[model samples]
Target: MKKAITKRLATIILAFMILTLCLNYVLQVHNARNDMYLDAKNKFWQINQILKQNEKETEQVKEDLKANCLIRAKAAAYILQYRPEITEDQEEMEKIARLLQVDEFHLFDKEGTLYAGSEPKYFGLNFTSGEQMQFFLPMLKDRELELCQDITPNTAEQKLMQYAAVWREDGEGIVQIGLEPDRVLESMKKNELSYIFSLVTADSGTTIYAIDPGTYQILGCTDGELAGKSITDVGVDPGTKMNQGFSARVNGEDSYCVFTDGDSVILGITESNRGLYKDVNSNCLLTAVYLVLISIIMIVSISKYMDYYVVRGISSVNQRLEKITKGNLDTKVEVETTPEFKELSGRINLMVDSLLDTTNKLTKILEAARVPIGVYEYNKDMKRVMATGRVADILMLTEEEARELLLDHVLFEKKLEDIRLHPVTGGKDVYRLPGEREHFIRMNTFSNANSILGIIIDVTEDMVEKQHIEKERDIDLLTGLYSRRAFYRKMEELFKAPEELGHAVILMADADNLKKVNDDYGHENGDRYLQGIAVILRSCKAEKQVLARISGDEFVVFLYQCRDREVLSAHIRELLLTMKGSTVELSNSKEIPVRFSVGCAYYPEDGRDYRELLSLSDHNMYQSKRNRER
Candidate 1:
């Protein structure tokens, strides 16, 4: 029988081990595929962002080229209107070039022959002659049209140049205007495309390549040898239509790749899926070997467990249970061979003693608890059966009086009605007795068998102290307004919401000449001046506004969700007038006028950032003070 049990246990364990190995293999492969797919998706998104940025930059460059071309064309037209008769007048032409802000000027006939140019070396070079033929041939065909070319090498100097041309307004010939390369380099210096498409090679042999769409050349690649090579050389056709994460063979290796079409470049990310999943297969094999070793160990262990101890130990435990069931609470098993069985017997003996001890301890704990606790049974009327631990002291009554009051059903119902609209058995409720009490009682009620038990504690002083501490932290003692930290925190919350900030305005003010007042009168007079300014700010009474004394001599105001900008401006104008007329009387019966340099910045119009808006307001305040001084 024992051998049969051991064989059954081994079969069950072996089946579980097989299931575990299969599940682990599936999960690992699934997770690996998921990770690879997410990585590819992220790379694709990055490529899209880079392409968008490139488009924006290219558009800006086009705008600059158009503006430069227009300026050069207008200059050429002006020079044509006033001709100097000498075709090769180098001194006159160079002067015109400097006035036009161009590197050189070329005058060409309708047949594309250069007549005069700023550079003496190109006095007779024909536009249709040599390297400039392909670009200038079009100008010869359309003599009246104005044109501008992208960067090209200057024939005379062999330096990069940008040129624009327009027909002489009299239709006599074409005049060409050239811009030096230095003027175009600033707009053309962005390398965001190369930075975005740099190669990323994963440990699993995944490789990324950046390809130029115009030349089909590899711009950047994980494979060093492939750089500067054509995509076709690496077996990828630039014109091939492919979806994202398409499975195909790349470079004669099984892989997955995707193409991201950009403004001037094509981005490709490829992964060798076969190389990535090989580790998952190896892990499965390793796990199977471990399971085999563990199965052998457990099978041997189960054989020993069943043969020597399991059967006899279970029989002894059954006998001990029968003795304990027959009113023998002290019964203990002594003939246990294995440690598991010996502990099992010891636990059974301790369980009975624990039950008896728990009952005695519960009674003692109830009587000794400092907080009052009570139990009441309900039938037609409620009766308090037990009360303990300062119940009479908290109730301010004798024990007999407390019991009599608790037994009154109508009085209990009234108290419950005052404390709770809907009574929940386990929820806490606070109740105050009919008196000017120093403490408030907190009670938790629950139903137990046929009775209700309540545990109560007094927690009055804690609530009062928490409120007092919070007030001290949030309020500024000197000005009776919000503290600087509190004002900043509130502003931060407003900045996170765009709509809230849109209707708000920030006001920053500085007390003008506070140092003069302190030096002439005293520091006490300076304090009085600051206090008087605070009073003027507090008298505004605008709803939903926050005023704070943010610095020693500076105050800030946040006017939130104003109804009208003009009304707010008008109100500020009135406040400034009031400030000019207002005076603070000193202890020596001398009156001093209050003046402030005030500035205001509107949110979503001046700035969306809190620090930026504050700085702007402060700058405006200083500007106002400077203007007044002037």
Candidate 2:
């Protein structure tokens, strides 16, 4: 492990060092070539300045020759008009040309034909004979026009010469003179770029060129082989770019090239890359040696530190983890050599301790929850019910049976089927086994996605309390009989079996002396008298009898399943005789006989509306009370 870590770290260090070296090498090479490129560009600019100056000097010399040529032509024209004898005298014109230091002279008549000149060669040449002589044609009509032309070949001999012409002073004819242009030729020779190229100095492998801007023609070159050739033939393209440097093969050798434009020339230079970066490569080689030595020292130092700190600390951590994974959770990680490792160790310990704490809390909670409350979850895919231990106890299963049920969902459902749905007190349903004294379990089930989750709670106490509350709601507290609402509900249920309602009677009885008893002997005696009437109503009951103390002093009896209406009336008469026998002993130990005003309404004979039958019975009860009072 230590070797792997160290090897990986060393690989990273070497990669970074190599990357740095490559970047440094590239930067140095760029700077070296840039220095040479800038120098060549500067030199091109110097060559342009020299070419411009030469152009200005050449222009001044050409202007001097133009004036000299015009002055000589005017002198010869003055002579031709004054000395008319020389009009056709070749010898005299020749002598006149010699006197003016000119090369030739000519005379044209008004017809615009050349009649004579110093070098006539028989002399019948017209002004239209050559392009050079056409300039004086316009002078024939305007004698005031004087013209001097640039140096060119004459029409007769095609010898290079400068010519100027004017009409004879008297308009007799035109006189023209020609000169050799010796001074202008001499000035241009000195201004030639070839002469300048010879004077340029540069390092070895560098070349200088002067090219014609219009033709891309190489006018001059320091390497003489390129002279007088098109720039393209020498692998140089004199493009529109100026005063910029670029890299290319020039003369089939890799070179740095720069170009600039002069007045009438393209000044350019090329330098070899070999000499450009020589010192840069040698310096980089030395730097690489030093970097290698430094890298070796750094690797050794880092490896030693790894052996002591990182490797040892991680080994201890791994050992503790191995023990914990094997169930020795008491093992603690305590490596503290470095802050990073120390934090890692503390986190591992805390995580293990948290695992144990969570397990303990869950155990205690499961133990506490299983007795009174249990959970059973089932999904179709699961083979067994996931349940609490209390579920088995609630189902009255032994340990072995519970285990079988937990392992097999089919067995669990079969066990559930064996439990009976029994009717408990107060009309609520509870679940138990088919045996006496079995604990009641309330089933609250939630179902979704073909799965049922039943929360089983031992609600024995809750059911008992609920029954007590229901009894209070449905029973009269004073007389322990059904209240008015319960009595009516039972009557409605009884009427659902209409065949049994044929002989049924609804009897309403009022204690005739209850008000008097309450007034003379306080309300305690009134309550006892009413309770005695409830007893009498309960005494003579038929198979389907319902008794209720409905109000302060009224008791109701529903006697059904009798032989006929007459038998129902006989049942009521027996109830009245019981009421007469029934009496209450008051708080004062005074005895009061329970006398009741009894009235009956027969069902169906009184038309089956409970309120109507109850109304008729109450009316009959008041009539009986009136009769007793009389």
Global local distance difference test of model 1 = 0.72
Q: Give the TM-score (vs. native) of candidate 2.
A: 0.40
Error of 1 at 116 (Å): 18
Q: Model 1: per-residue lDDT, tens digit, 16-58?
A: 9999998998999777767777876677676676667656776
Per-model CA lDDT versus the true structure: 0.72, 0.77
Candidate 2: regions farther than 4 A off:
1-363, 369-371, 377-385, 420-434, 444-454
**lDDT per residue, candidate 2, 487-582, as tens digits?**
888878877778766677788887786778888999977888877776777778677788898888788887777778888877877876776677
Most TM-score-accurate candidate: 2
Q: Which pairs clash in model 2?
A: none
TM-scores across all candidates? 0.37, 0.40
Clashing residue pairs found in predicted model 1: none
Give the count of colliding residue pairs in each prediction. 0, 0
RMSD in Å for all candidates? 19.7, 49.6
